[model samples]
Target: MGFILLALGLVLIAEGLVYALAPSLVEHLLEMLRALSEAQRRNAGLAALALGLILVWLAFRFGV
Candidate 1:
Protein backbone atom coordinates (compact mmCIF):
# COMPACT_ATOMS: atom_id res chain seq x y z
CA MET A 1 0.00 0.00 0.00
CA GLY A 2 2.82 2.39 0.87
CA PHE A 3 4.61 1.61 -2.38
CA ILE A 4 1.41 2.10 -4.34
CA LEU A 5 0.93 5.48 -2.71
CA LEU A 6 4.51 6.44 -3.47
CA ALA A 7 4.12 5.37 -7.08
CA LEU A 8 0.86 7.28 -7.43
CA GLY A 9 2.45 10.38 -5.92
CA LEU A 10 5.40 10.17 -8.28
CA VAL A 11 3.05 9.79 -11.24
CA LEU A 12 1.06 12.84 -10.17
CA ILE A 13 4.23 14.88 -9.77
CA ALA A 14 5.53 13.86 -13.16
CA GLU A 15 2.16 14.55 -14.77
CA GLY A 16 2.03 17.98 -13.16
CA LEU A 17 5.52 18.85 -14.36
CA VAL A 18 4.63 17.84 -17.93
CA TYR A 19 1.47 19.92 -17.83
CA ALA A 20 3.44 22.91 -16.56
CA LEU A 21 6.45 22.67 -18.86
CA ALA A 22 5.04 21.24 -22.11
CA PRO A 23 1.37 21.94 -22.30
CA SER A 24 1.44 22.23 -26.07
CA LEU A 25 3.24 18.96 -26.43
CA VAL A 26 0.56 17.28 -24.38
CA GLU A 27 -2.12 18.93 -26.45
CA HIS A 28 -0.47 17.84 -29.67
CA LEU A 29 -0.22 14.29 -28.39
CA LEU A 30 -3.90 14.33 -27.59
CA GLU A 31 -4.68 15.65 -31.02
CA MET A 32 -2.64 12.90 -32.59
CA LEU A 33 -4.47 10.33 -30.54
CA ARG A 34 -7.74 11.87 -31.64
CA ALA A 35 -6.70 11.41 -35.27
CA LEU A 36 -6.37 7.68 -34.85
CA SER A 37 -9.01 5.55 -36.53
CA GLU A 38 -11.93 4.39 -34.44
CA ALA A 39 -10.84 0.77 -34.58
CA GLN A 40 -7.28 1.71 -33.78
CA ARG A 41 -8.40 3.76 -30.81
CA ARG A 42 -10.58 0.99 -29.50
CA ASN A 43 -7.79 -1.53 -29.85
CA ALA A 44 -5.34 0.71 -28.10
CA GLY A 45 -7.75 1.38 -25.26
CA LEU A 46 -8.50 -2.29 -24.83
CA ALA A 47 -4.82 -3.20 -24.85
CA ALA A 48 -3.96 -0.57 -22.29
CA LEU A 49 -6.79 -1.68 -20.00
CA ALA A 50 -5.74 -5.28 -20.33
CA LEU A 51 -2.16 -4.41 -19.51
CA GLY A 52 -3.20 -2.42 -16.47
CA LEU A 53 -5.34 -5.28 -15.21
CA ILE A 54 -2.51 -7.74 -15.70
CA LEU A 55 -0.13 -5.49 -13.82
CA VAL A 56 -2.59 -5.11 -10.97
CA TRP A 57 -3.06 -8.85 -10.75
CA LEU A 58 0.69 -9.43 -10.76
CA ALA A 59 1.22 -6.81 -8.07
CA PHE A 60 -1.47 -8.30 -5.92
CA ARG A 61 0.03 -11.75 -6.21
CA PHE A 62 3.61 -10.60 -5.71
CA GLY A 63 3.02 -8.14 -2.87
CA VAL A 64 4.59 -5.30 -4.80
Candidate 2:
Protein backbone atom coordinates (compact mmCIF):
# COMPACT_ATOMS: atom_id res chain seq x y z
CA MET A 1 0.00 0.00 0.00
CA GLY A 2 2.81 2.40 0.82
CA PHE A 3 4.58 1.58 -2.41
CA ILE A 4 1.37 2.19 -4.34
CA LEU A 5 1.06 5.62 -2.77
CA LEU A 6 4.67 6.37 -3.54
CA ALA A 7 4.20 5.35 -7.16
CA LEU A 8 1.09 7.49 -7.48
CA GLY A 9 2.88 10.47 -5.97
CA LEU A 10 5.83 10.05 -8.31
CA VAL A 11 3.52 9.82 -11.30
CA LEU A 12 1.71 12.98 -10.21
CA ILE A 13 4.99 14.82 -9.76
CA ALA A 14 6.12 13.84 -13.25
CA GLU A 15 2.78 14.93 -14.72
CA GLY A 16 2.87 18.20 -12.82
CA LEU A 17 6.38 18.95 -14.02
CA VAL A 18 5.35 18.44 -17.62
CA TYR A 19 2.34 20.73 -17.32
CA ALA A 20 4.25 23.33 -15.39
CA LEU A 21 7.21 23.40 -17.70
CA ALA A 22 5.35 23.19 -21.02
CA PRO A 23 1.69 24.03 -20.90
CA SER A 24 1.58 24.83 -24.60
CA LEU A 25 3.39 21.65 -25.43
CA VAL A 26 0.79 19.73 -23.49
CA GLU A 27 -1.95 21.31 -25.55
CA HIS A 28 -0.13 20.44 -28.74
CA LEU A 29 0.31 16.89 -27.55
CA LEU A 30 -3.38 16.68 -26.77
CA GLU A 31 -4.19 17.86 -30.25
CA MET A 32 -1.87 15.31 -31.77
CA LEU A 33 -3.35 12.55 -29.64
CA ARG A 34 -6.83 13.64 -30.67
CA ALA A 35 -5.81 13.31 -34.31
CA LEU A 36 -4.74 9.73 -33.72
CA SER A 37 -7.22 6.92 -34.29
CA GLU A 38 -8.79 5.28 -31.23
CA ALA A 39 -7.00 2.04 -31.96
CA GLN A 40 -3.70 3.84 -32.17
CA ARG A 41 -4.37 5.49 -28.83
CA ARG A 42 -5.24 2.15 -27.29
CA ASN A 43 -2.05 0.62 -28.59
CA ALA A 44 -0.01 3.51 -27.29
CA GLY A 45 -1.58 3.16 -23.84
CA LEU A 46 -0.95 -0.59 -23.85
CA ALA A 47 2.66 -0.01 -24.77
CA ALA A 48 3.08 2.38 -21.88
CA LEU A 49 1.47 -0.14 -19.54
CA ALA A 50 3.79 -2.87 -20.70
CA LEU A 51 6.84 -0.68 -20.30
CA GLY A 52 5.76 0.37 -16.84
CA LEU A 53 5.25 -3.25 -15.85
CA ILE A 54 8.67 -4.12 -17.13
CA LEU A 55 10.26 -1.33 -15.12
CA VAL A 56 8.47 -2.39 -11.96
CA TRP A 57 9.49 -5.98 -12.47
CA LEU A 58 13.09 -4.96 -12.96
CA ALA A 59 13.07 -2.76 -9.88
CA PHE A 60 11.93 -5.64 -7.72
CA ARG A 61 13.96 -8.26 -9.48
CA PHE A 62 17.24 -6.48 -8.81
CA GLY A 63 16.33 -4.79 -5.49
CA VAL A 64 14.96 -1.28 -5.53
* Top TM-score hit: 2
Q: What is the C-alpha lDDT profile of model 2 across 1-64, one tens digit per residue?
A: 9999999999999999999999999999999999999999999999999999999999999998
- lDDT, each prediction: 0.92, 0.99
lDDT, residue 20, candidate 1: 100
TM-score of each: 0.65, 0.97
Question: Which portions of model 2 show Cα errors greater than 4 Å?
Answer: none
Alpha carbon deviation, residue 43, candidate 2 (Å) = 0.3
Backbone clashes in model 2: 0
Which consecutive 10 residues in model 2 have the weakest lDDT in total? 55-64
Cα lDDT, model 2, residue 34: 100
CA-only RMSD, every prediction: 3.1, 0.5
Q: Any residue pairs clashing in model 1, and if so which?
A: none
TM-score of candidate 1 relative to the true fold: 0.65
Compose the digit string of candidate 1's lDDT tens values, residues 1-64: 9977987998799999999999999999999999999999999999988998898899889986
